[model samples]
Target: MKLTIQRHQKGKSYEETFDVASLKVTTLLAALYEIKAKMDESLTFDAGCRSGVCGACALRVNGRETLACSYTPHDGDRIEPLNYHPVQRDLKVDKEKPQETLKRVLPTTIQNPKSKIQNPPLSSEDEAKFRVQTDCILCDSCYSACPVLAVNPDFLGPFALTRAWRYHTDPRYIEEVPNDSIQHLTSKIQNPVLLDTVQQNGIWDCTLCGECTAVCPQQIDPKSDIMQLRGESLKAGYSDPTLSTPSFGTPDFGGGFGFDPNAGF
Candidate 1:
């Protein structure tokens, strides 16, 4: 096996590789441990709750973001820290910023929590709307999977807004959602730094293609989350921020590689 990473050893980055033969490392974490214990002790990566509970071991495998705890290693696989965030050392990313975003979204309950509805009475119609949204683990996989984060670093990405959906969809929320909750959730949608983010760019950039959902180990559907934001924003009649973007500005026109349902060029 040969693994390469954007190594930030001491204070710099260089693509570093390691070779292994006669080997059988399962998870990416195990492979890194094997390399450290036997090959290069200085090599670094991050992992905890190897059962996939904690998202500490996130990395990019074959160019897609994934948690190393759940991802098995492949020979000649190019493994590095997440494509978006700075590599703390090897595969470990600084989750603090994303963590702060989670806190800001306030995606949970505290006082006077709504009683759990036994056989909750959501019409099958609403159930269909809410069911796919309750399964988020806050793994930030969508955050990493997003090309918005790759370039427009300040973009809120998918996790925060998706997380907002987790609570908003709760039938037991007890009271109306607070207006203060999202006063600024999309205010930064137009920040120049994040201008290139998806149509959910503020809440419209998401194609809802389920790429984030497909890669998530925890079954969190980031596409669903972004869609909820779009519906809510439109219901409130807020002008969609991306609509102001030049008709030609959409990546689909050219220059940027927006998702292509039709391709083969």
Candidate 2:
């Protein structure tokens, strides 16, 4: 199989072709590894926990974001580094930028409101809350696929927003008083982390393009999560900037709109 690799370093980019017909590897990472080991030792790329759990091998195949370790390459496939990231070297992009956005969201549980739970076992319904978000392996496929990042570099991309949603909905962050108050009325002041995502470049920026969900290897839908986050943000008294626009409510034009009957045409 023939492979075209787009490589770059120090602001210079180039493509190199390789023939891997002899090795017969099923996955792209395997082919690259074979080439590195046998053909070219200088070839640069990133791979960790080859089972796709680590998410270090995320790259573009045929212009789509995917995990190289899990993707099976086709003949004449074009492999490139992820988009919206600074290429550190061939097929290796800087992860620090994306990492920083995630850091800003505060992934850890911040100030659990309840010291001890009266009920020991969590209900299945409660467990379902955070179950999907936990599947995210931080592959950054969603980040690369995000069209918002293409135009707005400062946009806090999908994964971060999804993570913020995960933490916001966490039962640990809630003070469960059983029948004391409606679930919606629970005070948010106990955990400040939930409110952190209400600022600029938060959930409102998302265009709901669904590209993030399309590229997510783990099947985690950051787009859907962000929508849910928007709802939560609204319930917390934080309104979307777009929602604040004053509606004129259909311009009232008396008697045939622009022309008056008394005025001669």
Candidate 3:
């Protein structure tokens, strides 16, 4: 079978084709290994825990983000590095830059006094709110598939925003303190700093195109997480900055068909 791979070296990009003996159950990662072992020793890609748990082998196969360790290769499959990330070499992208966005927006620690007493109690019902988001492996698949990043590089991509929602909605962070308390526990209000951080170039900026959710190997829906974040932001008194801009250019004539634009009419 013929497999074409997009490669980059010394700041130059090119494509190379290799012929491999295909088996019925051979995965794309195995095919890459075969090519590297016999065909070209210089072939480069990332792989670890080839069982698809490590998420290190994620790349674009036929212009779609997928785990190379699990995806089967076809006769003319084209493999390339993930988009919206700096390629370190052939099929290996620099994820450090995109991963840093998590630190910039999410709270570093849960500030619940109850955690000091005991591991803050979490009910199954509360856990259901953000449980799916915990499956994120820090893979750049959603980041590569996000259309928002194409327009605004500063916009916090899907994974980061999903994590933000996870931390924001945690019951431990939202518990309120009792007025007369012997334990001296303080109010565990949600982090205001996080709410402020996501207001700009963040949740409001995402187009919610669902592409991020489509390509996720974990089936984590970042699009839905982002929508929930918007609701949380609204409850926290943050309005969409995009809505503040005038949609129509008609003059406001007091009460005659002139409604307040800031009211979101």
Candidate 4:
């Protein structure tokens, strides 16, 4: 089998093809190792854990974001680094940008008097809200798949927003005060965390393209989480300027591409 790898160095990128018909290369990662070991030792890629749990082996396989450790290779497969980040080398991206964004969001319990109180029994519903969100491996596949980042770099990407939503919906964060009912959790903190997501380049900026969900190896749906965050933001009196009054009876207006539900188009 022949593998074509797109390599980058210093600011220039070029493709290098390697024939590994003699090597027992099944997975893409194995094929990459074979290339480095047998053909060109300069071939570069990222891999860790090799089991798909760490998400360190992320790459664009044949134009789709995937983990190289788990993807089976075929004839003439094209492998490259993820998009929306600076390429450090051949098939390796500088994750500092996404890592910094994730750090900036501080996806943790907002420090507040209420948040540090004695543990209250959490209802199943409360636990269920953030259950799936815990599965995020921070692979950045969704980050690469996001179309919004292509246009708006300032927009906080999906995983960060999903973590924000996870923290916001946390039982402790949204729970009522014991005695006199207090303002929402956002009002208590000097800097309400959720407020960060309602700004100009926040939840409103999300196109709901579903690409994030499509590429996630953890199966976490950041798109749905963003929608939930939008609802929470609405409760907080924030509105997106892009939203407008519904234009009914117009088939072309916002009708999704596919078989029309109304069957008029």
RMSD of each: 8.7, 5.9, 5.7, 6.7
Report, for every candidate in turn, its global Cα lDDT versus the true structure: 0.64, 0.79, 0.82, 0.79
Evaluate residue 3 in candidate 1 and report its C-alpha lDDT on the 0 to 100 scale: 76
Kindly list the per-residue Cα lDDT of model 4 for residues 1-265, writing each as its tens digit.
8888898987898988888889988788988888889888988788899999999999998889999989999988888899888998999889888877766655345334554456676789989988999889878999999989989998889998888877777767543233322245345432254554346677889999999999999889999998987777666556776555443444543553333467654
Compose the digit string of candidate 3's lDDT tens values, residues 52-98.
78899999999999999999989899999998899888998889888
Model 2 lDDT, residue 262, Cα: 59
Q: How well does candidate 1 score on lDDT at residue 243?
A: 53
lDDT of 1: 0.64
User: Model 4's lDDT to the true fold?
Assistant: 0.79
Off by over 4 Å in 2: 107-121, 174-193, 245-265
Q: At residue 39, what lDDT does model 1 achieve?
A: 80
The Cα error of candidate 4 at residue 192, in Å, is: 4.6
119-184 per-residue lDDT for model 2 (tens digits):
446579877987999889888889998988877898999998888877766666543333333334
Count clashes in each candidate, considering only residues at least 3 apart in sequence or on different chains: 9, 0, 0, 0
Candidate 3: the clashing residue pairs are none
Q: Which stretches of candidate 4 lie over 4 Å from their true place?
A: 107-124, 174-192, 244-265
Candidate 1 lowest-lDDT run of ten: 189-198
The residue pairs that clash in candidate 4, if any, are: none
